[model samples]
Target: MIRRRYIDGRYGQVHLRENTPLGEPPLVCLHATAYSSRSFSALLAVLDGKRHVIALDTPGYGESDAPDGRIGIEAYAESIAEVCPDRFELFGYHTGVSIAAEIAIGHAARVDRLTFMGIPHFRALDFAAWRSKLAARHVLGERLDQFEERWRFFVSERAARLPLGRAFENFVDELKAWPHGWWAHDALFEHDLLARLEQVRQPTTVLNPPGHLAEPSRRAAAAMPDATVIELPEMPGPALDLYADTIASLLLAKQFVGGAVPA
Candidate 1:
C-alpha cells in the first residue's frame, strides 16, 4: 500500500509505497528515471520474508511532487534521511544507483547495506556518448531509428501480463517528465568514489540487470576494490528470483542484520 507523507526539506508530501510493511529495518528501493518504485514490483515479491520492501516515488515522479531544480543527489539523499526506520538497507536500480552511491558515500552512517542494480556509474565508458543518446536534440525527427534500438530494452516483461492496451499507456504516463535541468547533477556524481572506497564499510552487492547491461557491469565489479559482483541473466528463470538469491547471499555473508537506527 502507498501513503503520502511530508518529509521535512522535501519538495512536498512524498508518496511512499510499502509492501506489507513487515517491520523496521526495511529494505528501501530507489528507481531510475522515467520510473516510479512501482517498476520494481515484479522484483520485490521474491525478496524473502525477512525484508519489508519499501519503495519511494522520488520527487518529480509518480505521485510525488517535483523537487526544485536546486536539488541534487544530496538533497534526495537528505529526503531519504527522514525515513524513520530502526535500520535500513538501500537498493537502487540504474539511475537509482547514482543516488544510492551518493548516499552510501555521503551518509555512510545511515546505510547498513547497499545494493545497486544496473549500475551505469563507475564505468570506463565515456559519459559524453551516453549524454548524446539522452539528448532531445538527437531525437527530434520521425526517422529516429537509433533511439528505438535502445528503448526496447527498457520494456517490462510484465507487459504481457497486463491488459496491454490501457495499462501500457498508463505506464508511459507515470514516467516523470524530463524537465530541463532536473536531471543528473554532475557535481553530485563528480566526486571520485575510489578516493573513499574503504569508507563504504557496509557490504555492497552490485547486481547487473538481466540483460546486455550486465557485461560492462561485470567489468565494473571486477574493478571495484571492495564490491561483490553478481550477474542475473534475463532468461533461465524469473528476473526477480535471481536478484533475491544474490541479495540473500550478500546479507548472509555480511551477517548484517545491522543495528538499531535512531528514532
Candidate 2:
C-alpha cells in the first residue's frame, strides 16, 4: 500500500509513499522538475503489485520542502540517498533523467540500474540569451514550426519577468524554493550526465521520446557498453510500461544493472 510519510527532514525533505513488502528491492522513481510522484501513481501501482516501487517528492516539488532556500540537481540526488539509503533501481523522466544519472553515479553502490524516460536534456542559458535564442527559432521543418507554436504559447509575457531561477523551474521547483530565499538555476543546469555517462557504473537504459532529444540521448546511452536503447513508436505521455515485464524479469533474476545476467 502507498502511504505518505516525511523522511530526511533537514533543509530539504521529501514525502515518500511506498509499498514495503513487495519482496523485492525498491525501484525508486523520481519525477521531472515540473512533475511530482503523482504522475507515476498509475504505473507505480501496477509495478508495485509485482515488486516494491518507491517514489518521493523531491525537495521543491510535491509535498517536500526545499532546504537551504535553493538547491541544484546534486542536492536533490543527495536527498534521495539520505531517505532511501538501501540498494535499489533509479528511474526518471525528462529533468529527472539528469538527476537519476548522477544519483546512480554518485552512489554507485546504492543503484542497481538507471532508466531514463523521455530524456529531455535541453540546455539552459542566461534568460536574455535564452529568449533571443527562442526568438530566432531555427526552422528545422514543419514539425519544428508546429512545436514552436506550442512552445510560444507556453511562455507568456509575465513569465519573462520572473527571476532566472524561477523561470527555469516549473511548478515543482517553485514549490520547493523557500518563500523568500534566492533561487538556484545555476546549480542544476551547470552539469548534465550525457557527458559523464561513462562514469556511471550502473547499467543504463534510455527510452527516448520521438523528437530532437532522441538522437543525442541515444548517442549518450551508447557511451556505456552495458547501456540499452529501446525505441518505441511515437506516442503521447510517458511510456511507463514499454518494458515493464523485462525490467521485472531482469530484477527478479538478479540481473543487476551492471549488465550481468543472473547466475
The candidate that wins on TM-score is: 1
RMSD versus native structure for model 2: 9.5
lDDT of 2 by residue, 65-183 (tens): 76655567787677777778588888777667777877887888878887777654444224355334332323234443434433343334223334333233333343343232123
Candidate topping lDDT: 2
lDDT of 1 by residue, 1-263 (tens): 44334444357767766656665577778876656766656445544455577777766676677766645666776676675364787887766666676677777776878877666644446666665554333223455464343335344444344434434543453334433222543423443433434455667788665554576566655555567876555433323423455554544444444654322
**Clash pairs of candidate 2?**
11-67, 12-67, 60-176, 203-257
Each model's TM-score? Answer: 0.70, 0.68
| Candidate 2 local lDDT, residue 170 | 38
lDDT of each: 0.58, 0.60
> What is the alpha-carbon lDDT of model 1 when measured against the actual structure?
0.58
Residue 76: error of model 2 in Å?
1.6
Backbone clashes counted, model 1: 1
